[model samples]
Target: MRVKVNALILISVFALSSCKTQVLPENTVQTDIKQVVNSADVVLVDVRIPEQYAEATAKDAVNIPLAELSNNIDSLKGKKVVVFCNKGIQADQAVEILKKKGVDVYDGTTWKNVKAIQEEK
Candidate 1:
């Protein structure tokens, strides 16, 4: 019974941790990502799979799906990077990983929002 209780506790801990979203610290996120996008020094990344990116992605945005993100960290380390996935889930995951690696990154979350912001500029 004790073993079962310990296992249940472990599982619960894992579940809760996985559900937590990795967001930019309030100070780190800009009110509008366009400020970054419009800058010459920034990188706009689409974190969705290549197939999805091919369907449609913001102009000037590069594809770097989440699975392959870690391998490309060196190229992004010091750059201001704005990232987004379809609805933000994968983008959030990518942001968490990037932050851990000390990359200057922002989670733009939804592609729709990214596009809208760009169009307005």
Candidate 2:
């Protein structure tokens, strides 16, 4: 019985390990953002709150706070959405949410980074 329990535990561990999600390298993610930044149809979304968004953000970036993302999915359809926040944390979470809903989404790291990319263009 002890051996059977150990074998079951091992199998479960292996299965869980195999289910780990793949995260793209930072450089690779940056490359993806750069490639799409200049596209006319691309949508830059700032995931910060309305107050923070009012202060400053990338030009042409729509204000869609992280908490409101799900309800606003319909507005984001048919466009390549790039999400960013004050820092990269909220943006990363937003990317996961959007990706699950089949939106063409990319993490733009931070609002500052997205603004810089826009200025470069």
lDDT at residue 87 of model 2 (Cα atoms): 78
Superposed by TM-score, candidate 1 places the C-alpha of residue 21 at a distance from the truth, in angstroms, of: 21
- Summarize candidate 2's per-residue lDDT along 41-89 as a digit string, tens digits: 8999999999999999998999999999999998897789999998799
Question: In candidate 2, which residue ranges exceed 4 Å CA deviation?
Answer: 1-31
lDDT of each: 0.87, 0.88
Q: Which residue pairs come into collision in candidate 2?
A: none
2-121 per-residue lDDT for model 1 (tens digits): 999999999999999889778867646555666776677889999999999999998789999899999999999889899999999998999899988988888788788888878986
Candidate 1 positional error at 90, Å: 0.6
RMSD in Å for model 1: 8.0
The residue-level lDDT of candidate 1 at 36 comes to: 71
lDDT of 2 at 45: 94
TM-score of 1: 0.73
Error of 2 at 8 (Å): 19
TM per candidate comes to 0.73, 0.74
* Clash totals in order: 0, 0
The clash tally of candidate 1 reads: 0
